[model samples]
Target: MSKRRFIAALIGVLVAPLLTVVMPAGTASAHGWITSPASRQEQCRAGTVSCGEIKYEPQSVEGPKGLRNCHGNVGRFAELNNDGKGWRVQNVSRTTTFRWNLTARHRTSTWEYYIGGARVASFNDGGAIPGSTVTHNVNLGRTGRQKLLAIWNIADTANAFYVCVDLNIS
Candidate 1:
């Protein structure tokens, strides 16, 4: 066979095997699922209040038996100011931001905080939960810690929510 023809045939043969390999649609190759909340009840639980601040950790359900990192739930983690101010605390008139450490299973899961039962802010932790113990920063007004909860909204599996933290404003 001519050199060009031989090269073309070789290419075709290699490409055919790859194209024929059945790739399950929607199959996640990444290990781990989002371990967030499943319902509003779990997300609405009070937060952990102490030292003029409220801290929380979302609930993570045991994922499907597989790679430790392969498959988890979706949830939210948050911290609120519980200084008896409500939504506004120190700083008078200012908007502050914090770099919070998070522990997530999915590579695209996110964490958000709510004020007065409204979605206020969110952060993506590069798909890694801050493990069992990680504190992420959040913006809060000069108000004592109020009713706030972190959430984890998983897409698949039994929708689950956990009030991993609660707080009482001082």
Candidate 2:
């Protein structure tokens, strides 16, 4: 083959794999959210409520694990943390099941649920990779309306995803 043609072929071989490695397929699908009882983001995704950019990518609200804000501290998803955004509260039993719809599973540290200002339930994953779908049954143990915060902690990362769910328990 000609030297110029050989050089061009070599460049393609080197650059093609780097491009794939830099941007792997489905890397955008790297997390999830609580779908059951519908977190605010889920409500946006389902058209139960109007929202901003989060409506397009509800599973992407990742932030530090210890914070108590929605949008996972992401400014673009800040609408999720808004109190007067007209989110519909879902009615549930005292004991309700939360379902996580995971697009990409990661090694998880824990899953925590909080109501008002108190932690009511937590599941420890012990650094194991979780399934695409996860469910947790939480005993709310109280009646009336409440706002719930659900957190998914990643074992290997310094971040977690957050979801704020409104509920009316009976």
Candidate 3:
């Protein structure tokens, strides 16, 4: 056999096995949530707050992009929108470093933080795949028991992950 034909056959032999392997369809592989300073979902997952379905899947609070609410406007995780849930406030300096623990990595567009309908900080990723963990030093302008909304905008999709972190800044 010719060298070209032999290489073609070898490639087919190696690739056929991989193609035969089955994978579940419609599986979501990219999800993330804030852990440090404990977003509401993290607080729920850690038993620091009494929450609903979000406790089991803290990284799944995904919804349409450009939304300002927590829980991503999802009905099941809607508990994140409640202010009376006795959420714990983390004390941090004016410039706080928010840490994200990503369950799966994806191309990121931007990370935005909002408080009382005002945007405080935004980090643009230029549509690059993020690492399993991501952190940003955000200057939260206001102080004294503020609920900050953090949004991770996906690069290709119209979806974004949302988390709310309550903070008491000094």
Best by TM-score: 2
**Full-model lDDT for every candidate:** 0.35, 0.90, 0.91
Which of the predicted structures, 1 or 3, would earn the higher TM-score when compared with the native?
3
- Determine which window of 10 residues in candidate 2 has minimal summed lDDT: 22-31
Question: Which 10-residue span in candidate 1 carries the lowest summed lDDT?
Answer: 32-41
Candidate 3, lDDT over the whole model: 0.91
Candidate 3, residues 67-168, lDDT tens digits: the string is 889988899998899999899999999999999999988789999999999999999999999889999999898778899999999999999999999999
Ranking by lDDT: 3, 2, 1
What is the TM-score (0 to 1) of candidate 1? 0.32
Q: Which residue window of length 10 is worst by lDDT in model 3?
A: 21-30
Ranking by TM-score: 2, 3, 1
TM-score of each: 0.32, 0.85, 0.83
Over 4 Å off in model 3, which ranges? 1-30
- Of 1 and 2, the candidate ranking higher by lDDT: 2
Error of 2 at 167 (Å): 0.4
The local distance difference test score of model 1 is 0.35
